[model samples]
Target: MSEGRHEDESQTRPSGISTDVEVGAAHAIQPPRLENGEKRTDTEADGQNDQVELGSSGRNTTQEKPYSVFSTNEKRIIILAGSLAGFFSPLTSSIYFPALGTIAKALHVSNSDVNLTVTTYLILQGLAPMVIAGFADNMGRRPAYMLCFTIYICANLGLGLQNSYAALLGLRCLQSAGSSGTIALANGLVGDTITSEQRGAYIAFASLGGLLGPTLSPIIGGLISQNLEWHWLFWFLLIFSGVFTVPLFLFLPETCRKIVGDGSIPPPPLNTSLTDVIRHKRRAKRGLVFDAAEQAELRKNYRFRFPNPLATLWILFDPASLVILVATGLNLACFYAISTGASAAFRDEYGFNDIQIGLVFIPIGVGGILAAFTTGKLVDWNYQRHAQRLGITVVKGVRQDLTDFPIETARIQVALPILLANGVFVIAYGWTVGHKISLAGPIIFLFFLGYCSIASYQVMNVLMTDLWPGQAAAATAANNFIRCELGAAASAAIGPMSKAFGQGWAYTFWALIYMAFAPALLIISRRGIQMRSAKKAREDKRSARRKEKMNRKG
Candidate 1:
């Protein structure tokens, strides 16, 4: 049956009709229409069609394959690898917390000088992704991953051996530049392989490493710093990242849709994995070959382009994107204030040792873990509920036309309540810790704060992917840019702010600031569709103009 369908697809491809039509022939499904009522162009629909012809095989029959050509297990493995890569970014930051005082003393510098390293690490964290994300979106995820890991591994080595404050500050920025793009790339991987309907859950799962890093790192950092010296932290990061990088390079297949197109087309030799290379040899022996013409067709108009940091800034300036980013960035600023201040506050107020301070972070981490499990499923359920309410049929493994769908409402409805709850916890955490309440009192609030913060992050992460689609990495880079800048400021200011204002009022200020941004969510929910429509119309006009010029040249 598959062979017969393949033959039919081949015959139909020679004619002017799109391969999407052939794939949909079984179900009599029409091509999706744009907001303006025009059918999707052949180029737009080709991705779907390629999945049917090229992805249909022993395990992934054309009828059964999801929007991504990769199987369920394959997707899980890829996301896991991406998540591990993301893990190192936050781990690098948080692991240094327990050693901050030690490092300052060893280097004979003020504590504020050590804190400056943290601040600079974050600033680079925001800016570096802009440089890498455009490359990831245009080139491929694997190569970008390779580039980041290589830079990260080298920076860690330098950081481990460095003795001076100057060396520490410079290497930390280098480390930040190396590690930060992993989160953006991980988010991009989700966009590459998952559809919007199923994206909420997958995004949460992919984010587990990042969300858990802050939760878990302090404990590990405390253990290492308490037993050994501050330098071992970087040594640990170097070894750990090296272990993950080697396997990822060998096993993880490229998932960039532009480069591989739903995992159907073969990636360039550089992007191909060792496992994929082995599999390709076996397939060739079985008389399955990707002929020259097919390969050329896939490569047409796709060329290597220079990475543009400005592309990230461009997305930042978009009306809808700006609102979403600012709101999310404000939330991140609040989170940073809490996490960054916790070590100092706990040490000073509660008179906790490094190990005890590290242990106190457990509740927050626990909360983030719980949020990852619960919020993801909740968001998915919300998506389905909204689809049902709109009378839109959502087919598994098929991309839905979101042209008229209330996606903003579906995502934000789940987030708004979570954000409000988060604000409450932020205030509670501040007051409990400020009054020198029982350790348990603040610990409990920390958990809820962590839960609410990460849950809100998951929702926005998924929403950003939905909003930008193919440019998920760039969108996330912009998100990182805004939030990290705010976070850097918050990290630097939180100490002074806490010193000036009491802890209770300090967090209350952050809570109020967070709440101020809540209206941005409501605004986007109400007006996002109109903004998207306007943006799409403008994009379509530009596309039309380019095509007309190309035709005249021809």
Candidate 2:
């Protein structure tokens, strides 16, 4: 699904709207045209261009829009802001693990009751992002971002101060709702600004904060929870949100294509920074203002769209999209299941204490960070290699018509060998722990597991963004939803599986079953371009039927 495309409906026009298909692109990669029943207009004739560039992605390339490449500094800042935003969810989720027992003791709740909040958190973490992302996709990025952070701040404050089990349950749900939007919004911002050619590095940077958070949070939480009271965890979140997230979000200008209509259109006043607002106030005091056309342009562009959860979930119906979602989710689940079982296994098998078990987890985090950076570079490199080998002229700012490139081969193919190696580590790690081998064995395998799993997972993520360029938020929300569900399920089952079958057999089940993804990878890598073409065709046919019915009714 190499759909490096844009939603031209969101592009600004002189009439404040644009037509769907390019007027005269006979071979252009575009939505299927209405059947040619009427004579063509001379205006349409005049619009034809002789530029016939080839792209194997099966879409016509003639009608694609050219975009401005942001300067290095601007790119860095956008990724930085997005990465900071990405950090909050995992931080909020992981930092609480060390404090759960303390929290239960302070609130005088049963262990089971305390564990229920974790489940509640995971469930909301899966679902809330769907609703929040709808707004990010439809309305604007900045407002949605502000909304999520505000909810997060409030939830953290309440959790820190509250002393009831019921309050504990509710606040964690609220916290999950708020924090979960960061990854979706971060992906949206990156998609909004960067072209697919150069997006890999930026996606790595945007995701780095998420990887860093979970890795550091437990160690930090353990230290804080052991020394201070558990309430300080939320206090730390509150201060961090206030000091870091709020100021950065306030200064971050809106970047959604639906709202701003690409770089050519000026951003709305509200989307601008506090400095811009002050400058505007000063200008107004001096009686300076926009002319008639400018004012009318603002009026035309201003719109409010309510969130639609269904729309976010609908992408799963696409076969290629669904397969990618499930595979990535399960791969993520592998990590979650293993990590959740790690501490108990360490304690029982090696006689290690809580702090030692937590310390051993650091290598997994390091592996994740290393995987993101290294995989990002490899993804970009692979994309270019595929492009050149296929003879597509690689353009930096221009979205390449991926019609010709086998993107699955480019993104995921390179990672397959790595994944096979990862499976071996998965089996070995399980056996190592089960056999109570040297401590170094499990650590080494866990590190490799993190590296290989993340590398493959990152490829899937990049491919997803490319497949649904204009709907990055919804697509990401869907991805996150699947991963969380799988994570929860896998986390729950790991203990049972281990208890029932023993660690060696339990993880051997995982290793053998992982081969199931091979068929999906083959299907997607081979069939993605055809699936995309067929889906577009079906969409066009349905649209034509609807329009014909409307005409007859009229």
Q: Which candidate is the best by lDDT?
A: 1
Sequence-dependent TM-score of model 2? 0.83
Candidate 2: which stretches are off by over 4 Å?
Answer: 1-66, 100-115, 275-302
Candidate 2 clashing pairs? Answer: 28-60, 29-59, 29-60, 55-404, 56-403, 56-404, 57-402, 57-403, 57-404, 58-403
Which lDDT value does model 1 have at 213? 93
Residue 518 lDDT (model 1): 83
Candidate 1 clashing pairs? none
At residue 170, candidate 1 shows an lDDT of 97
lDDT by candidate, in order shown = 0.75, 0.68
List, residue by residue over 372-436, the lDDT tens digit for candidate 2: 88888887777777655654455334443445446666776766677667777778998999999
Where model 1 places Cα greater than 4 Å from the true spot, the runs are 1-66, 281-294, 301-304, 547-554
TM-score of each: 0.87, 0.83
